[model samples]
Target: MALVEVKVPDIGDFKDVAVIELLVKPGDRVAVDQSLITVESDKASMEIPSSHAGVVRELKVAQGDKVSEGSVIALLEAQGAAAAAPSAAPAAPAVVEVAAPAPVVAPAPVAAPPAAVAAATAPAAGASDVGAHDPTRPPVGLPHASPSVRKLARELGVPLEEVRGSGPKGRITVEDVQAFTRAVMAGEQTTRAQAARAPQGGGDGAALGLLPWPKVDFAKFGPIERQAMSRIKKISGANLMRNAVMIPAVTNHDDADITELEAFRLQLNKEHEKSGVKVTMLAFLIKACVAALQKFPEFNSSIDVEGGGDALILKRYWHIGFAADTPNGLVVPVIKNADQKGILQISQELAELAKKAREGKLSPAEMSGATFTISSLGGIGGRYFTPIINAPEVAILGVCKARMEPVWDGQQFVPRLMLPLSLTWDHRVIDGAAAARFNAYLGQILADFRRVLL
Candidate 1:
């Protein structure tokens, strides 16, 4: 009898994906290439296969554990079977196939944040990172949480110590903070942590100045199927809730004349057809946004710890994220330094990233670090949409399908392609005047690409 360690094969570019399910337990027989544990990346979920045929001695990985290439998955009893030694990085990576539960893709966590945009980069320290940005917070000793988790707690006004940790080593996760808020909103003050923020004049103080969510069973009304949301939708749903609830968002809708811009795009596609690069209107939008951000730097800023939640974090560099709709769910893939790239390059990168997004192959680095965001329903066709602002980033630009309509060009009526623009900004940091100016300037750029040059 030989005891051999079962390690995760090369997962390729996925250095730290969550183990969502364990397919085998101790004493279970596993054949070579048999799926062992399921790990989920932010966009796609895959099953890790066993490298050897053996009886499982002990499971080394657990659900919710983060595993990477060569991470031990289990210990196996080889039973005198001769198995080739596994390489440090296997020549062929673990196959990325959707498991039985269906592939998971949350809107952001559980970011899997646009809190992950902040939290994913945060230090998983044992102590709270709250004191760094929040000067006027409560005096209670800090709880063990990542900086992003602390940020979510501060925004929701939740006491971290009160929320139970479900992560490894009792680390408070973003979901924990969200769950605490949901509990309070449901009129269940299971703990006294929220007492400090309780409304002064309240009815019995049973809940946090809110009514509980009504529990419902929809089956009585019609036929129902219990469909699970992709892991992306769950994570993003949490991220969107945090941002939408915390930020004082305001939307301003306007239209851009993209008749000439559309013509230019068509021309670019014709010229680049030989090179296999097709230009999209989003490329022009990205460039136009870069110009608008330059003209109104505050639109590219974030509300932060500098002013004790009253200040702005002005980003000098421009990184723009665009919402991409996938069969799984909606994901935002970003373009770094839009100001540095041309229309052709942006379009090329856009194609590559969008392909990766559609294939569920986008990495975290490609999705995070967006200073601003754009959500376009152009291809899908919509007049206007109010997009939620991604946290840390104060503004989002929403674009809709362009339509041709008669316009009064001073003397006569002319057909012009009108592209609807919706600019949503955090009212706390940006006033109505600034939001209007940002949208107006953006329209001006789309109307004439020459404005981007100046």
Candidate 2:
């Protein structure tokens, strides 16, 4: 039987997407087009499907490892029966031998530092002589561990070689990696000791200049259980950190009188209830934002990274992304051509996308190409929040609960519904005056929907 290498398919412009889950293991029979692993970018999560029907021989990449298109993800032993089918089967590629050994030792409990853990768990590109970022060739010896253990190590950033395995025949276990990381972070292990275990300059997260994360044994205080972060959090966290650090953000808070808008929305909802198209505040918000964006084209632009951040790419069309909360985490599903969409159409699509997001069914295309974003906390009852601007979009609007407030009208105070709005923008592109004007304009449009025509 011929062995074939399975690679990642075309996943669009994203690079270095993290492998989040493995769908198959060695000895498992996989059919053509079956998912082999799930990889997640900051925008969306997708599964890599198998191109050939075969038995899983070995997985090449582990969860937490960043991969690009064409990166080998697994090796498969091609099934002979698959060749006889009418469909054109993928041709076998070069063969790579994978060592299969049964575990001989039981893993013991342990903990370690994040970088050391990543080093210990993630496979190096080369042996002791290889540089961390070298791309010349493959590493000499692969680490020994199940895919799940390898994944855990990658998440923790532990080098498998540095971690001492307590499992049979010195097989590394999750506890061993954790113990190693704790020792490294707590300064129990010297720099020399860490260097000896893994090819060391420093661990993965070492360049941040931040002090080592404090290690705490929560069980010492009370009953405790460790739950791993969801894949969405792991992927989105990095993007959030980057956006927060690289972008100089400024947030402006304002209020919009939505009493009339709310009444109109309710009337529309009541009228359309039988039509099955429900009206939502978000739909109106989306339309109002589109009007503001049209008035201020600079707010509908992104910093062109390839242009050394000196140029802006102003989108001619309006595509808005709304943050949707799900069981997994927050995901932004973009509504394309929002400028051309009516309130009812936008509301229907928003509901559909939100449903898909909650169900984890949103595709990568549905999550990309947002010219601007809105994070609404109205349903959850928050007053205001500084929403991190979704790069490379320059601005994001945060919406909060609407409340009845006393408004001064001429000589009398009257009750009106006021909606809180928090507009956060990149200071590099938008100054305080522009941001203030943008917010004021957005508020005006929301207060009186007819203003959108101007």
Candidate 3:
């Protein structure tokens, strides 16, 4: 059996990052997208997934070793059923396709994964000649394509430089690459420049007329040490940048009275002390948010941009995602079907997910498919702060620490524990009046949670 070399996917702008953890060894069988190793940059870490499935024949890199895009991560010996096409007659096809040059020698998907992950690895048939993947000769000045699109390009044996991006900012998409692969299989002649067409100055960035990012050499003034930015930080930073720059966001700050609710939480904690279930305010918040979402369905909805940006996707199910702080970087692990879970159950799951996040063991699936998000800085003190909306999600609730404040009850001021709520919403999806009403309704729920029954 022939062995397939599994190479590292693009880690966006960074290079030669240290491989901090090894997830598999020789003789171990692995599946597609199963994390092969965890690589650490300066401040945080991220896992690199395997592109092919098979028995691990050999290991190419070691812990503490540096890796970059196109670097081979492992040697996989393909397994049963789907392992014959690419390894068969490798030399004859190369000799026959010599007259018309194809830069990438995309081979058959010798170990195709299940239908769920098939789109990411399955190569288009009759696309190109079978040969060794050339890591050094990547097409120069290739336009930007996401990791997923790049993965598909590698599987299809199509050079990204030769694929035109039909998406915004001349970004290449999976569909665009698929179309280009069909063209290549038909032996269509096209120039590289023609294949990578785009509007000048990009429709989005040109209007800003932004200046170049500052480049400073601090070493000239004092001694300094350089470190690579952590993988998680880099990934999250990109998302944060996109959310901050693109979204028309507005933050509405209001306070919720939770004095009575706090007392109830303490009483429940005492009753469940023997069972090891410690109820917290967040659990109650989740329940209240669900009820509030039911009251105002728009808050539980996402923008329908792909369907011509004319509607909202009101989700029938409620899955709440809460921000969990970790040593590496911030990650949000969602509690699926949160509407059906009780306060104790939600609290236990929150503790479990937070533990996994701190250990850097949370899977990508655990952090995805969130309809709404809550970023709480209650443990750590803060009055109010705006949280960037997680894309597709139109709103995020930012919870700050509670404080005892004076509230006027008719003629006299009384001390009350007020929980600050900073609700940041997309102005395009929600207006000021609706946001105010949402906060007021949520405040009412916290003041007397029995309103949820109503």
Candidate 4:
């Protein structure tokens, strides 16, 4: 089979499932078992992975579409034998039709000799071919199209530049290129400006309208050694970049007087010292956050972009995730149901979760399903710093070093331990006034542990 229609796989006991997200778009190359879409039913949300490695030719379902078992989700150009075999002669003409948009040589005929099999199966191989992906090419400056679209464009002899993009931010969609080809074939007056301003694969920074990323030889000035980043950093870097760029984030800075709270914590530890569970500040913070979440439910909700980007999914359960610094990188271990647990229980759970995180033994379930997160740098001695909001959760609390500073108590200055709080939130979900109030209320709760009871 040259092309395959990817259908919804066996989803036990679910029907008319709403698509929550589309992970792969038309023209993207996908690996076997790679997630293509996320569907949410009443019971749970699950990702649908590709069963075959191939290039996505067309998306049959979009976000918010209700799909059932055997529903065609996408069309794919199967890789390897399914795509290259001479026995697939029946679909050769259709394959040729899809390739009409690209400027590539034709595949060998069905009756070609065995010696030409490899050449027939191989994709076009011109380094300058816009459809032929050049590994050395700087991917940033080139026209945006999926791998399948580029392949189709190559087959159709359509330079992507001549086709005006109708997709988001001048992105060339498959339809756009196909329409351009139709116009050209109909003998309509179409300008071939693409040939004049052709993208030079790796060297065309002018296409993206941005300065090229500076490449430097640091070894020339000083001795340098190359070291690979840790697995956690490498993975988290991409997520951090996407979140930072996409989210309109705002950080509200505040100070919490933990003078009395710290003393109470020490007393609690002294009281439970023999119990083998020491109460930590993070436990109290978790409890305080849960309380705040209950009071301000909006802060505990996620904007459902999959649901048309206008709805918020309010979570009733409070699962607090705390950032743990391991030798590898930062990891967050969520304490499920922090709202139901006492300080001692929360502290014990946090300790176990932190231990598991440090050992890299934390399960996926342990790290997921968090309603809120806290990143504390109090141990490392930072005054204040903005923390990135972990997506799906609208906010993150960043705690910094607590220092004993003199405070004017109406008449005299008294030394009080002030813990710095940096609350970062998505501006789309939270206003400045609301964020300020939240930070203030959090500080108030920390200043007087009694407020938690009230």
Q: What is the C-alpha RMSD of each candidate to the true structure, in Å?
A: 15.2, 15.3, 13.6, 16.7
- Give the Å shift of residue 434 in candidate 4: 0.3
In candidate 2, which residue ranges exceed 4 Å CA deviation?
1-206
Evaluated at residue 309, the lDDT of candidate 2 is 57
lDDT of 4 by residue, 285-305 (tens): 999988888888889999875
In order of listing, the candidates' clash counts read 21, 30, 1, 16
Alpha-carbon runs more than 4 Å astray in model 3: 1-207, 221-223
lDDT of the candidates, in the order given:
0.73, 0.73, 0.72, 0.72
Q: For model 3, where is the 10-residue window of minimal lDDT? A: 91-100
Give, for candidate 2, the lowest lDDT window spanning 10 residues: 91-100
Candidate 4 weakest ten by summed lDDT: 90-99
Which portions of model 4 miss their true places by more than 4 Å? 1-209
Judging by TM-score against the true structure, name the best candidate: 1
TM-scores for the candidates: 0.61, 0.59, 0.60, 0.59
**Where does candidate 1 have its weakest 10-residue lDDT segment?**
200-209
Which of the predicted structures, 1 or 2, would earn the higher lDDT when compared with the native?
2
| Candidate maximizing lDDT | 2
TM-score between candidate 1 and the true structure = 0.61
